[model samples]
Target: MTNLDIPATPGAAVARTEASPVGRVLAEQAVRTAAAWLAEFRKSPSTPAAYARDLGLAAVVEHHQLQDLVEAFPLPSVRTLFTRSRARGVAPELCWFPMLLDLGLHPVLDATPAHVKGWVALMDEHRDATGQPVLSPAARARRVAALSSLLRWAVTEELITANPVDRLDRDRAGLVVDRHHSPTRGLSGAQLDLLVWTADRYPGPQRARTAALVALLATTAIRVSELCGLATGDYFADTGRHVIEVTRKGGKRQRIPVPPAAAARLDAYLATRPDYGAVAVPGQHGAGRVPLLATTAWRPGAGRRGGGQPLSPGEVWATLRRVARTHPDLAHLADQLHPHQLRHSVATRLLEAGAPQQHVQDLLGHVDPAMTQRYNRARDQLHNSPTPLAGQLLERGLAALDQDQEHHPAG
Candidate 1:
């Protein structure tokens, strides 16, 4: 039996634990090693909460009987699972944690193939309070993939004899199927037009800003994260085209060309700033720190001032929702509209307009051309639908037959 001391904080009494060498040994060294790895995996403050949660789970498993923990684990209520499933725009990592915690299957040496199969079955049987399936097929596959990776790592470290998850058939696990052929997710042309129109006329302090944001999103197709991260210095005129430099997902910086209409709206909105666009200029010393879409700052007597701070991603999402709800024309889309959908709409529109596949891929900052190809194929299918063409042909043939009968007096 090894004694492990886990300190809550500096100068605090250490919490001591004694490991049992029986079923599913939760080795202290393994916990310590995983903790160190997870700490190093922390990319930003935004990510530490998740790492801490993972570490906490490891701690819980360390102090408990593995079989007892699995059997007595309090699974998340069906209502809670449904609530999480209904949420839009949740981070993928965040979505996996609760489900993983509910399973209560800790990584340990004694964890067997049968145990893993049981866990998978439990997931398959999970239903919402209303008796609807909680996890979609794609979502189930994603959870399994995340678990498989973790178990594969444990196997490599000799913590487990084999990965039980690897033994599960891919198709049975809801993986390796044609799940990608689902309907295209984006606003139609009319919905998009109404959305922009509403934003342009939105009655509030955020009117101009919202309008500019909509135009920029529709044209540039930048991710919401990249859009929120834009500083004053990020936009500039290059040659005859207006360009905005953005750090895309995975830390790759790229310059995206802004359409003339979007660029004009953005410029007009910037000009209305209290600083007259001076704050957004890159080389203007302290002014370069100004956010392109700044949050409103309220003071005791200063009323409201814009351009003090950058808008958070949540704030951006809320703003779009607010605009959708406020405008009668866009009310139908209030629940469905989101920033990423704008990205999808742009990709689809560009592909339909005959833009080269590689160019569309670059515009969307996609690393894989295969993703862009999906959009292209969807556009082709929409245009080449036989139903509409067949209708047109039938109409023409009927008109010709009517004309012949009229000329020949067919009585």
Candidate 2:
């Protein structure tokens, strides 16, 4: 059999040659193994290879002895699928896997919780040219979140059976922090309102799209990735509610009811285009295939007589920054305004309006309530505390009983 047909184990490959098995494969960068696996699977008539192959053999996988391509890579191959579009996001995270391999967790099967911790520690300790730590708390959080995402993808690809990142003590590992920093601060309530208003001042063509994009993000709090991934058909009537479906982090599709202002703006913007916003749902095909927030500048001369390319996350960032710069009122925010801050603004605004904490958590799609609770920096104020409100409610009942005794001489 050709070397191509042979499945090399770490020990076996080591025995065959005195080279470090991890360094050997990684030196060549293992792009060949990842590509070969993808090529073999892509040939399937039904595309079983699109998601399956020798994924099964990887499951006896947890206790470290690395398997062939099972431990080799779904990394570079999966990254290709995402990097095809800038909006797919997380390509930078995927880039980190090679560094992970360099740390001796070659097959991915070898990554344990301790290795994950050490990987993050290395990143945290690394210094940049400024002589400060390269990763801040927020940057460290992103690395952990990115690692979690990668490990989860590996699990789904069945490259390995268990996720070491999942077992991580997220808070202890410094991924979750109750402490708020300047980085976590979002726009003030008035600032959020000003942001949407700022969209109206977008210079030149397609102001309707600019307004709708800003309003939807400011009002609903969807991620920039979710906003960019939205298909025209994702907006549809659901039992009298105007709901928009978005692919959330990790490919989870969620439908959130659009508020009146966002819905009105979106509908008005959609009216300007050929599709009129009444596109088919994603699974239903072509009518819904166009981008919901397409940029007029993109593919201006191409495609159907109507639509343009979907906005990338970078485009969304620029749009917000541009809108902020347009108005004197938003000048201070021009440099710092971003799509994520809009999302953060939405969550905080909802909480400040006395919306239930649980509802806010659900609205923001946070799996951990702690993540949601971290947004309310003012929640501890006794003046605004719900406990006093409860006591006041009881006082009204006591007052009523006192009135009854005065009127009827009740015991």
TM-score of 1: 0.59
Clash totals, every prediction: 0, 0
Task: List the candidate 2 regions with Cα displacement exceeding 4 Å.
Answer: 1-95, 100-118, 127-132, 145-176, 179-183, 249-252, 275-288, 297-307, 374-411
Task: Itemize residue pairs with steric clashes in candidate 1.
Answer: none
Q: List ranges where model 1 is wrong by over 4 Å.
A: 1-124, 129-131, 143-168, 177-182, 272-290, 298-309, 373-411
**Each model's Cα RMSD:** 13.7, 14.5
Best by TM-score: 2
lDDT of each: 0.53, 0.56
Candidate 2 lDDT over 56-147, as tens digits, reads 11111211233343444344323322233222222222224444343443435555676666656655566668888656666567656645
Residues 164-278 of candidate 1: C-alpha lDDT, one tens digit per residue? 6777886866566353353347876555655665677789766788888877776667777678767778788655566677755434556666666567678878877774455
The TM-scores of all predictions, comma-separated, are: 0.59, 0.61
